[model samples]
Target: MKKIKYVALLAIVFTILFVTKANAQTWNIGFPDTTKVKAILTGNKLVIEGKGAMKNYPRHKIWKDSVTSVYIKKGVTNIGHHAFYDCRELKTITIPDGVTSIGESAFKNCENLAAVIIPNSVTVIKRNAFERCTSLKAVSIPDNILEIEEYAFYECFSLENVLLGNGLNQIGDCAFRACHNLSSITIPKSTSTIGEIAFRECYNMQNFEVEKGNIKYSSVDGVLFNKKQDTLVAYPNGKEGKYKIPESAVVIGNSAFASSKINAVRIPKTIKTIEGDAFRYCHNLSKLKVPNSVEEIGILPFANCDSLERIKLGSGITEIGMYILSQNENLLKIKIAHKNLKFSSKKGILYNKSRDTLVMYPRGKKGSFMIPENVICIKKGAFEDCQGLTEIVIPENVTTIEAIAFQYDRNLKTVTNRSTTPQKISSEVFSYVNLKNISLFVPSDVVDKYRNTDVWKEFGQIKAIE
Candidate 1:
């Protein structure tokens, strides 16, 4: 039975390939003449050779099981955008020295492509050029290239070796993201700029080397840092156990520790800023203490960390972004020091310094919750995804409830608002909730006001408080 299945699969593969070849018509990039760009199929190989530039290779599904190889001859100056995209069966490609640029997504998702020589004459590799080329094992970037664009080599799971050229100046964001088998990489001395998330999600890279005389970046214990060592750059996802931020480091670059395996981290007091998504998705991190020297905390810094339960904020943190600690299912408390001028908390719930704005309510806080009388505003996503609450009391002073303030509260059945005036709200304030089954209790004088309000009118029962 197994042999028969294998044979059937082979037959299906051949049938698809043959059908593609049957549909093969001469596709010329520009004006079709003897001197212009043209493609022709000879057996399983697609031969593309001409004196001028080819506008584009083909669409994603066009070459799925058909073409096995592509040979761009010496006179072709450019390989246009998405030329060989999603060519699953293509294994070998020969790009001649006359080609000057390989356009965006030129070889994207070519799963069977193993190796290719980019000629020294090529200068630009546009965005997503070799993204998801799973079987690609080795590539030597030519010396004349200047930049490697975003998602250029993203998610090449089996890619093991990459040779960067000395003349290359910039590596774009997420250029080599998630290349798990890549064990090491050497940054050439001439490369001055490496974009954010450039090496993130690379699980197996153990050593990051910066060639001596490189002035902009450096490496310590296989981690990348700025030349002055004040900014913490990329940390290998494969790195294990606890990590301590160096004493000299003041800034943690965005997405620096995202999706990492670290169980604990110690932030030194010298650190001043924790950028957006800096510690995002660190599954093993259970606790964190932001030092008193940190002045700003960016969005979603510790989000999606399933095990994180507690955090102690420094007194100096005056700028805190929205959803900074969102999606932490186990989070129960956030302790803020007294000197923080912009933020404060009541019983582990985050609020602005004056307690006038309810910032975030813990998702794990059980039973009923009450907003303080001083709170005039409920910020966006203040009660988002809080699965524990079944009832809530909005103080009389709260005149505003931001979008999605009570979203995803499946068990919430009652809401008592003391406000006399109809509170302003949008249509999506109670999204993903069964408002028709929930009751709204308002002040006696505001019963009609609550029942007639835009979003409040959808409540199943509206009553006047005694």
Candidate 2:
């Protein structure tokens, strides 16, 4: 009877300890004393009464999943970074009027969070502050807010209406990306700078308006443009059909045509530059021409245009960015005008004028391809997703292979390296490739050296070639 009593006493002690640990995990830090803050969980609602700023929500995952509603009392001065991240069931939050800032990712991935009220005292909305809040239908920024950082409301699919305050000055890149239901935006006159892709992928947006007297930006036919209208910024993703760019546009901003469904685009002669990702994922676009006045083309300008079959470059083009025309599976030819001074092509493959760097290889080109003897560098993403080539031979002069150089070539079975020394390659060059199923053939004298290299050593078979 005495022994049984002792066992029960020990069980009681363990139960008490477990409850203490769980409670400790839910408590927020930064309080001067435990008595200065009071947090009570009643059913699904969490009530936090604190005298000063609260530290970022506890890192413990348990607090995130259990809290359905949070009532932050007026004494709290700040909401720390990632305070309520990934709280799938959190539907409503009351941010008090004294709060001055909302940190990065403060409420990221709160999929069911439907509404929030930003108090007038808040000055900054940091990067990814409300990212992926899929059910949040609307929000209004108070007049005291000074900045809205990158990806602040990214992928908020249900967000339809936004009311911006007059005090805001700067908006960061991708601030409102992929908010499919947002119908329009009006930038306040006090705003001076808006970053690239700030409103990209807002599929329902019919227009973007700048408040009258704004000095840095303007709108032309609902398209965002620089105040002078020399740079063409974002084109609403919802607008479809053939659209000719204005003849006065000198530069195409980053992501200018990203995720657009336009059937055709006519870049005018006045354009001097096409920035990175300018035409990415425009699957319906089939043809493009760079006029003679153009001087540069940025990275991946025409990537993933599935129906794009032909491209022509003008004579004045001097700079071509990496992966400029990658993933256009139907692209059969890329022709450069004869008077071009910076680049050339042989057999439809693009290269620098001196032929020292292989720029990109068309994915639609068939059969085996041999790298020219004079090429020394394979540019980044040069051969990405090129499944048509069953084999490749790298010439002896080639010394470096950049990142993702040969990625996703599932059908590639053999590679012949003519270099006597093992050429170094980036770790991502062969990413997603089944190295054990592919064979690597190296010069007979350097077979062992190639076998010792990091990426080459993983080949299924390393054979000596005379």
Candidate 3:
């Protein structure tokens, strides 16, 4: 059976490679007149020698699977897109100084394409240039290049190190998605925009050093200092169990520790901010202590940490990011030192623990809910997907009904709001429930105010108190 399985798998792989080759119709490398090169596959390397003809390498037509490592003749200048894409056996490529442009997806999805040396002469790198080369351990950006287009080197899961070229300015979105093995990166001074999710879902990347801070950007240790730079990040820089961040460190970039294996962390007092997801999804993480200087905790800062139950947020923290502590099944108690907390639930708000208004519930709780009136706003999605919640009530002083604030509750039904003549209503206040449209009681005098507004009309028939 094993032999048969292996044979079948090999057949499928060959079939796919053949299709990729079949679809690869006469792709040109340098353009103009160039002899067609034949694919010479020997052992693991695919040798294309320009047939020792044309006085140069073929500018057009390459067999994508015919070669594991491409050797360009001395005169080649441009390497076409997807020319060597998905060459699993490809390990290394040496692009001589002669090549100038490396087209998009040129070496993309080449899982085994490990080492590459881009010479100084190259200038433009098109989109999806080096995406998903899982085994691509490391590569250095050429200082001469001006831009690295979108989706460059994305999903290089095994990628661990990158040497940024001096002239680099922009890093496109999802550029380093799920680079599980990537440990650290340095952002040079010339870099400007670290695009959205530029490092999204990088599981193993722990620390970064930004030499020069961006005009409006910042960095922590080395992680992209998220908007609020107060939070600092430190992972197992080496395979150690204990670690501490220096006081000089400011912000802990988002997702900096999303998937780190650290058991504990101590955030110093110098940190004034903690970006969202700074320590998110730290599965093995068990304890955290935020110093008193931290005034804000960004949204979902500690979400999805299944093993985490204990965290210390000092007195200086004023605002708590929305769902910051959500889904922490082990979290049963949250001790807040700030008495005058101003927790705002406005517009699906991120809770401001610094305000000292709303009381964070213990991880495990039973039944009815009542949000104090002093709490000025109720954040959107604050209690989303809370499997334990059943019945709840809101105080009258509350004003906004944050979008999707109370959606996706399977058993939660019937919420009574006490806001006598509070503010306007928003959409999706009560949805995804099997029960009847739960009533929201508002003073009859102000029902007109909410009813007239376009935001509250379609959600589910609202009723006013007489």
Candidate 4:
């Protein structure tokens, strides 16, 4: 009995040794011919050591799930691209002082990584370097860093504080997008270039503070603007109520007021240009008046404003972009000045000054609509999401209908086409409309032509317009 017990104990000891050996393994992830750098993993700790730049591992070479900590030795000069990507269990990282750069997506999707020490020796934080580090709470940009590339900290929901270094010269597009908890950001004086939508969708951001003597940028009332204060750069998403554009301002930057909570905005006559998505997603904005000084307006500048009810355009406008007034659930009218040479309005509907092309129809307009006698083309998304439209009359001169011209008009029950020959159009033009349940009316001589047409033939009833 004593001998058997001793044998069982020995068996247990050997099993423990085997499990330990299996859990503690090593991998040489360095390029011996080019650099002396090496990555060695033992148990849950990963150690990066030696000199020169480390090899870029787009995918994890070590057991990423098992690594809870990382210690980079002082001699390493760079952290290669995607070196520790998707290390879900990695909780801490200690970057040494000699590392000069953090490569693209080096630590992307490290969900459990709560803290990282980026040394001052680093100059560039490449695109997506620390993207989606959901648990990270704070970051301090080192003084030597020159640029923070696009999507570097995107969707880091728990990040609340950021300290920008004075040496930062540029911030790439969408660099901090969707960082919901970020409350405030200060732009350093050396930053000269800020890409479009760099701070978009930061819902809780309240203030944009610019350090004194920043020659390229400035801030007033927590709003960002160029140094001369002529161009509005960004509006904090957390602020509420009416805002009056300064008389000195001439241009509104791209996505300057996107996802903001302002109920109204007063534009001055000096403002000449409105960039794309300037006021998008401002659910509380109710009215807008474009002054005569404005010469150009970019695409979707005022799209998706749920409370927008009226827009007045002045005569000086010469250029307008597509879908500027799309998806406003409560918009009721677009009133353009009669002297305007490029566009016109009839019964609140927007059209080219010649009145030959229908540009936009308010989604809030209800009941049936009669196409004007001179209209020749229907623009794309002209009648999209107009849920109250029950019938439409197409004039004889109408020759073309663009894609999604009548999309999402779920309540439309009838369509009357006055042409003798069916106008060719794709089925996508009527997306979400129940073609089989609605009736199509055509001129008496074209009943057969309408029934034989590709997209028109799907109608439930084809009848002569007696």
Candidate 5:
């Protein structure tokens, strides 16, 4: 009988300890004046009763992992920055109607958060507010919101339905980038600014619909454009096959065709400018012909085009950006119109009009190559990723080799430099090349010069030309 009584006493003491620990988990969420607001964690629920905005919490808040649901009372006015960041287990949140803003990264990386009620009182959704919320399937932005900041919904893989409020005025850069399931979006009339790459990499997106009476933008056949339709703002990534640029379009906006499914594009003579990354990552694009009306080409316009075999540049192109044709694994040739006074092409290699500066070496070109006798300098990344190059001979006239000029030429085995005096170059000029096994041949008279140079000295074998 005494043993039974002792066991009962032990059970009572354990129960009391458990209750104390549970009560200790409750947190005061407001400022020093705790009387105004309080937050309690009971079981899987987070109950927040407040009269003002909650304080921002660091990424590793104690309750982030345990809370599966949140209920904010109507008196709360705002959701502070990073308030629930990385709350991977949070599945639902009831936002009160009086809240005016959702702070930056307020719910970022909450991968399991599937449902959230954004009340009509919110005026702004700060940057990265719901980024990486993979389980969120739909969102309806209320009519009172004014802006959605940069990267607000980036990489939200499951988001399929988005209803933008008529009062929204701006969509910041990359706000909805990489939202793969987002199939279509309608821009309300009140939206005046849609930032760059906002819808890039949305592989299933087929159209961008703009409401009528929009003063700043318009849409034609599901293509987004400026009010006058002279600038092609964006091309639906899901649109396939050949597309002809309208004669009225004078410019191709930045990233307009990035990661699109289009295989071919016809450029009309009216196009005068091709902005940066205009045709980047169009894996199916095989060939292109730039018309004579185009005068400028922005940075990396044709980079990473896996199937791009040839490109013909028109005579009017006076400005060309760096690495414009880099990383194109299948690009075999670059043709420049004879009338072009600034650039030229010879044997498929790009060069300055005077043939003095080697601009870019076709990454697809195979076998050995001899630099032209007139070439004096090789531009940065001129021969980057030329995987098939087994040998290269630099002429006597070459004086400079820029950074990364021959990087990643893993197959390169021999390099013969004809200049008696070694050209000064950075160590990055031949990055990733097998310097320990490749042979370097230099003029018999100055083999010692290459043997002492910084980058050249690293080559495995230094031999004098016979």
Candidate 6:
């Protein structure tokens, strides 16, 4: 009976001691003070943990200068703002599965971080999470991650590759700014919106390979490789000079050859569309031969070509761009395959040989000018600024004369036509300066044809002077 009594007494004392300790147990999260928690440096790394249940890892104010790698244990779900910010040497981090959200500036300016693996349970990664991590090379996002917030990977210089998550839908603005080493990148098909400046200044970015017909802009073999049927653009690496693209290529991208030195070019028969600045500022390009397959021409495609002297436009082309041959003063000839076609200019006129448009004279030649026998029409401004012209003759088969065919001309005194058919003449044929003293001399049988038409309206009466 005495032994039983002693055992019961000991049991009661132990139970009292256990209850007292449990009542005093208060939560202490990692913080500056021990009462709350302690973020102490154990050697090289900083360790943070919770002291009690309710005070589970308080959000912010962590990572002193000595911190290297942070470990968010099983209970950490919410990491406060700027928690591990600007820790330059923090190379690696492993967040336990229970951790969910990472706050803004959480891993900002961690320059030595090479790579990161986003956990599968993380739904959202807040703003500037990995901003300016210059040493980071690549990152792979988990399949469950839905959104990556603003500037997450902004200015990550060494980030060369990124594995997008399946669930990821969008990339925030300026997400990958100034990533110089990123030579190639592949964006996932599930992504819908890529924010502005997301891939800006990625100068070395050469190609983007995606699902068929998905990417709007891409590159192939150091050439602009777009799958959208936009255009096959080629850019010269060292200098531009005499490019011979196959006739089968189409479309030229904007600024593909901006500010280059190409002296001459031979465009093939396969080209269909020429975009803006297709050949701008090609300072030395003296001549261009456009094939018959082209239809439409864009502005400044050949602007400011100082040495350009001749261009042979294709037969099927309809609309001509403004200033297509601006500032090409040395140009004295243009050859086209169509006779009934029209061309405008400030000076030179279109000379027709059979169905082909022939030479354009800037300053009309003096002495004798012979029109090809099978010529059809003479277009506007063809001889506008030709002040030196004195004598001209129409060959046996000449027919049409457009507006200002001989405009802004002086010292022209005589014209002789051998054409059997009457020429369709406009009143402004010689209206600019001096057709008053000029006389119309026609074939004997064609006297009535010249008299009836406006060709000799401002000239002296036509005498059968053939």
Instruction: Name the top TM-score candidate.
Output: 5
lDDT (0 to 1) per candidate? 0.87, 0.86, 0.63, 0.90, 0.91, 0.62
C-alpha lDDT of residue 69 in model 6: 76
Q: If scored against the real structure, what TM-score would every candidate get?
A: 0.89, 0.81, 0.62, 0.91, 0.94, 0.42
Could you give candidate 3's per-residue lDDT for residues 1-466 as a string of tens digits? 9999999999999998887666544322234445543334444455443422222232133355556666665556666666676676677787767667788787777777777888887887767778888877887889987777778888887788888887888877667666767777787777876665566566556666676645535554454443445434334222335556666667666665666666677777777777787777777777777777778777888988878867766777665554878777676456544442553232222246443234345344456676766666655665665556676777776766665566566666555556665456454644565435445555667666555656443325566644
Give RMSD (Å) of candidate 1 vs. truth.
6.8
For residues 264-340, write the lDDT of model 1, one tens digit per residue.
99999999999989999898999999989998888889999889988889899876655888888778888888788
User: Between candidates 1 and 3, which one is better according to lDDT?
Assistant: 1
RMSD values for the candidates in order, in angstroms, are 6.8, 7.7, 10.1, 3.6, 3.8, 18.5
* Prediction 5 global C-alpha lDDT: 0.91
Clashing pairs in 2: none
Give one digit per residue, the lDDT tens place, for model 6 in 160-211: 8877776667777667656766666565656655554465455455555444
Which run of 10 residues does model 1 get worst, by summed lDDT? 26-35
* Preferred candidate (TM-score higher): 2 or 6: 2
Which pairs of residues collide in model 4? none
Candidate 4 residue lDDT tens string, 1-466: 9999999999999999888767666555555435387676778898888878877786765567788899999988899889889998889999999999998998899999888878999999999998999999999999999999999998898999999999999999999988889989999989999888888889899999999988999999999999999999999987898899999899999999999888889899999999999999998899999998888889999999999999998888886654788788788899899999989999889899999999889888888999999999998888988888999999999999999999999999999999887999999889999999899999988899999999999999999998
Give stretches of model 1 more than 4 Å off. 1-25, 30-35, 57-65, 464-466
Model 5 TM:
0.94
lDDT of 1 at 301: 90
Q: Which stretches of candidate 3 lie over 4 Å from their true place?
A: 1-71, 80-94, 112-127, 137-151, 160-177, 182-240, 296-299, 310-323, 326-329, 339-367, 370-377, 394-400, 413-425, 431-466
TM-score of 2: 0.81
Q: Please, what are the lDDT tens digits per residue for candidate 2 over residues 198-262?
A: 88888888788889999988998888888999999888887888888898799999999898778
